[model samples]
Target: MTNIWEPIRIGRMNLPHRFAMAPLTRSRAQADGTPGELAAEYYGQRASLGLLISEGTQPSADGQGYPNTPGIYTDDHVRGWQRVTSAVHARGGHLFIQLMHAGRMGHPDNTAHGRAPVAPSAIAPGEKMFTLGGLKDAPVPRPLATEEVPATIADYRHAAARSIEAGADGVEIHGANGYLIQQFFSPNANTRTDSYGGSIENRARFGLEVVAAVVDEVGADRTGIRLSPGSRLGGIAEGEGHEAFYLHLVKELARFDLAYLHVAHGGNEELLRRIRELWPKALLVNRVNRPLEAATADVEAGLADVAPVGRWALSNPDFIERFRRGAALNPPDPQTFYGSGAAGYTDYPHLEASAASA
Candidate 1:
């Protein structure tokens, strides 16, 4: 039986364990989109995980969705992330920076430039976004011109290059969570008539192109992508053929021979099984809020090569240790999940501290 603690090779990197730290947006970056000072400590504390997928980092200035989320496009952003990568690597950990483009999810007040969010179409998600003022309606984004699409893809390519330069093990294209890539996947969000829209192939084109561009810049072994099939977040409705579209997309992505396919399971067993069969490389399944035994069962049953956890990883920096010893976990405070501070970010007690206190 393959335990969660067993070492596994994903691409060129041999992870120490099978449990990876799923990207969680802590909103701890500076206003300029640079990572905060404590970002290194925050990530390094969880370095015991097999892999660390950093938060949804913007690929460009206009790609920012929420306030204080980090970016990898600028020199300052690169410098800020260098410290984080160094800290993780020093602890013998592998880090993958998630390249995310917010698309229509952006609020003018949230972004640094106050620019209108761009998307495949002009349709607004009809969702509210968090801003400095408070939660506000997301504005209808400006549609990208046919010529401008390439530039957007270039942004991802450049971001991938920057992440590598910052000493990251790889980059994971954030194609999930109703972001830019998912926006293209959603028929309701993307109603364009261009070559990049309409049919399933066309809708999957933008994401594939971005992946190809990143792979071109950084080899396939250092590239990965996250996908959330049939997700209804950010007011997106995939309509019919959601499963078929994702199956096709995964088949096409398989051609790249990328590092891993991180699937945020959205209650689709058939699609999940199909993806596992279609993808030739490593598979990381995110079963949100699932217990340790369930996650371990996923890997043991060959359903996933590894399982990524969110809240447990967030509240327990020594999650692997806790799981190994069956130690009691510190419950995460939902209020402090996203904010600028170390209260809930790094203050969670490890098993040693808990034992000493008791």
Candidate 2:
């Protein structure tokens, strides 16, 4: 039997297979940051995957940077997400909500309160994010004061608790993709002199604190963190010789005994082997274009405990069985990705072998 199809334990849950769905932002939520009506059907369609990580959701109003992205801070957001979890569980899928704060990667026209973005330092991301008006330059976010830093971290803790309350199995802290936590990790973005800056340890403080807080709210066994060690997205540049930075970060994070440490842009065999040695927990590996062959290879090589696929899962409702049988997949229409209706959301075709029969 292929180990790819074997059962494995992640935290208290035993997954029937090693394939998981990575979080992908579709920006299809309500304008007020509430989960839209189609979300339950969208997620429920792909519930054949063992695990599904939802899109990056803001923990607070200030944390939001993209239009139509969901939030977990408000009562409405929690109730909206409950529908998704219930729908997924009905099909025997485990779900985790990824808490993402976009930091300085925001424009005023995108947020409801129209507030300036916040970050580890008062730096601009040297790029633009989509706003209601149009694409515009990202503003220089206000530097978080030392006294107020704890509150920012607490926001993540509150969101984690809310996720479990919403019936999610766990939470994944979004410490990647040039977001709030990743902003601090990048020297190009974090220029603070306080304890949360300067050395690698200091720069990693905010991320560690956020993770610790979430772990406290949810148990360590039910928590996870995602990182993209080499990704320079949104003008985020980690300083030279920062391989040591992630090495140290992963080693320290290993002490928490979390369920998993997910890595984006960590797919190379050598790099994966090195990090796998340091992380004592399950390694959920994902990066763009993680093909079925590569995923099978990594799992067989023991470099990854699970391979999380994102966009492919977006278009194919029966992704698991299709991959298992080496069948063709449905191509996603880019135009309908963020649209209001179900044109490309829930109407995608599933295999005839699937229960839905497309």
Candidate 3:
């Protein structure tokens, strides 16, 4: 049995333990798409998590979907992230910045681009998004012209370079969560008749190309990707052939010899087993809505190399210490989960604070 505390190597970096801080969106960035000043403190406080994956960062202005989410495509963005990465490194932690393009999930009101969102097709996701102006229904996105696909892929490569320049250990391409990459995986979200649509292989083309581009710009050892095989987030349906689609996608992704494959799993047992068999490198699994007991059990049973925790890590920056000590965890406040303040961001009580208060 593999104990979660044992050291493991994922790509070029070596971690002291297996409990990683999952990527989370806190909506706490500057208006110009730079990370908020408090962002450094927030992340630095959680450096004990060993491997902290930063929140989803937009690769371009068009990638902005929610208000105040950070970007990695500009000089200001790079400088802002430098503070974050430096803080994490000073405490001997590794950070992987996740690059996410919202695609149809984007709204013009939230971004300076002030244009309709883009997707594999011109379909609307029929979801409401909160913006600086107010909440609004997602607008039907503009279909990317065939020629524009290459440029879009280039954005990932550029962002990967920017993440590296900002001193991150690696980059994780956000291929999960009904984002641009997952939009291409859905039959309803993507109806293109070109090379980017019609078949599973074609639909996988854009994401794989984006991954390849990022790998070329930043070595494979410094690149990773997250995928949700059966996620229905953002109203996405993976179609009848989803199982086959994911199997093929996993097999294709294994060729890169990348850092690790992060799976935001939602109870797709057989497919996950297949992925485990096919994937050759590190596998980080985040079981949606599962408790720490279950997560650790998965690692103990050889199900995943690492278990990334979201809210637990959020509400308890000293989560690793508490877990090691078998102490209590601070309950996460849903109200402050997406707000821009220190109330729930970095103000969570650690074991020492809790004991002192008692």
Candidate 4:
């Protein structure tokens, strides 16, 4: 059997296949940042992907970054997501919400009450983000006071609890792509002299604390984390050298024995090998925009237990079947990627529909 089609055990969840839908941001939520009514339909359509990691969802009102992105903190938000989880479950797929806190990546205009974004230090990402208006420069975020760090950790914990209440199978902490947690790890974003900055251990402290808090609220078997070891997105530059910081961070986190560790495309072989050595459990790896041959080769080589596909899952609802049959893949339209409605969201056809048309 193809490695991608084989069953893999990730934590307590027995996945039917190694193909998962990687988290892709689609800003199609309500004005209040709650999930849209059609979210259930959207996720249910792609339920064949074994595991579906929902888009980056904010843990607090201030954590919102893009317009119309979902939140997991409020009552209405929980109710909205419950419907999504139920739909995916009915279709036999495991779903996990990717809890993301935007930090300096957020713009005041995009946030709930125009509140300034906050981070580990008083550093801005030195970039612009999409707001209700057009692209605008990121406002200088206030450094999260040392005393307030506990509250931020609580925010993640509460979000994890809410995710379980919403019937999600698990939660993936968004510790990648220069978001809040990644900001703490990057020296360019975090320059504080407190416990959350300075050395590699100190810089990784906030993320570790948040993970522990969430794991306490939700068991380690249901908590997942996504990391980009050497990514420089959102104006974040890893001045501390990616290999040292991530190596130390993964080694520390390995002790928790969480559900799984999902890594993005930028990690080096040595770092990945180190992670695999330390983390003796499930590992989900995303190949980003790489070709199918490269992705399949990586899976065949056992670099990752599961290989997640993002855009392919978005454009092809039956991505697994299409890949299994070696059929053509539907190209996703970049224009409708972040739109409001179902134009490019859930309208993508499955293999049966395509075959019937042909």
- TM-score for candidate 4, please give it: 0.97
Give the root-mean-square deviation of each candidate in angstroms: 0.9, 1.9, 0.8, 1.3
Cα lDDT tens digits for candidate 3, 1-358: 9899999888889899988999999999998889998999899999988899999999988888888899999999999999999999999899999999999998888887689988999999888888877788999999999999999999999999999999999999999999999999888889999999989999999999999999999999999999998788887999768999989998999999999999999898888888899999989999989976686977887788999999999999999999998898999999998855898999998799999999
Clash totals for all candidate models: 0, 0, 0, 0
Candidate 1, residues 1-358, lDDT tens digits: the string is: 7877788999778998889999999998999989998999989999999699999999999899999899999999999999999999999888999999999998999986898999989999999999889999999999999999999999999999999999999999999989999999899999889999999999999999999999999999999999999888888889778999999999999999999999998888888999989989999999866876686878988989998989999999999889888878889999998874988998999899989999
Report the candidate with higher TM-score, 2 versus 4. Answer: 4
Candidate that would win on lDDT: 1
Q: How big is the positional error of residue 284 in model 1, measured in Å on the Cα after superposition?
A: 0.5
Q: Point out where model 1 deviates above 4 Å.
A: none
Candidate 4 residue 244 Cα shift, in angstroms, is 1.1
Error at 321, model 1, angstroms: 0.2
- lDDT: the better of candidates 1 and 2: 1
Clashes of 3: 0
The deviation in Å at residue 104 for candidate 2 is 1.0
lDDT (0-100) at residue 32 of candidate 4? 85
lDDT for model 1: 0.92
